[model samples]
Target: MDLISSRLLFRPMEERDRRFMRRFLSDGELTRWLPVDYPCPMEQVHLHVDRRLEHWDKHGFGTFVLEEREGEGPVGYCGLEHVTETPFIDLRYGLVQSAQGRGLAFEAAMRVVTYGFHGLQLPRIFGAAMPDNKASVAVLTKVGMRPDKRFDCYGSNLFTASVDRVAFDLKAQPVTHTGIYGAHG
Candidate 1:
């Protein structure tokens, strides 16, 4: 299934996306705050994409390749996945350098979070960002997730934020049905 926001398209990750995933994950600037080191190994990149594919197969939903609706190459990815070793589901997103500071992440994330709560009937969805990644934190906050906790993971101290169906419904704008359709929709 694919999710559509006003400016971006969210298509399910596929095996063939390895090439773009490799290049995107290799960008040190874009990935600096993420758990993985910049210029991630090709093997790790393959593993990363494979993990997304595996996640979708195992759990029925995972990250989506983010692209502009106008058909430019993929800019990044956004969606929810189970937090390893924990009983939590986390929302994540990343975008190309050229695509940052343009509200694309927020747009894609807002759509995904809405889907998580209303579409998936998830009780809560969480997000974690490095304490210094104000942009990422801001995006999560804007999506109605409140600060939940702080923890160390993958060599970085992360601040976790969360939103349950009730809080999300209170804070979120009335969802205007748009491009949402298909399996995950």
Candidate 2:
């Protein structure tokens, strides 16, 4: 259950993360790539974080605040959770602008993807990002997920990417909707 790398550490999201989340989620430039509306109010940020905490209880896994090291402020958050009825565990992450472009997002996400498969014994993990959000696409791709489809999500068109461990092991292919429940065929 240890999801740690040289540059990142993952811990359950905490109330103190509100300020960092507010700053990151509210950044106009960064939010443009995200499905969230820009200028996200602090209230909405609070609500989102609270929901993530609840998700941890119900789903056994949810968003986690990413730390730079053992004793540093949170730089971002990432997690794997099966939202609502979604058959696949969804991977999500965001980093403050200062933290971007340093490969931290990919590192954090890959760690969670590994935890989802090896720790939780999940069959698959998926993530969605705006088609133009190259950074996010790169992160997913770098972690061995391939684009599975283009679809509408939260009023925006996004490219969905996923990877199945068995498929990757057998065919070495990253494109698949097969999840813990079943495949998307």
- Each candidate's TM vs. the true structure? 0.90, 0.82
Alpha-carbon lDDT of model 1: 0.83
**lDDT values, one for every candidate:** 0.83, 0.74
Q: For residues 1-185, write the lDDT of model 1, one tens digit per residue.
A: 87887778899999878999999888787788886566788888987888899999999899999998886888999999987777788898999888899988888888898888877889999888888999999999988988786423344467778898899877765545432352233
How much does each candidate deviate from the true structure in C-alpha RMSD?
2.8, 6.6
* Candidate 2 Cα outliers beyond 4 Å, as residue runs: 150-156, 167-185
Q: Write the per-residue lDDT of candidate 2 for residues 51-142, one digit (tens) a residue.
A: 88788888778898888875578888899877565466788998877789988897787667766776688888888888788889888887
- Runs with alpha carbons beyond 4 Å of true place in candidate 1: 150-156, 174-185
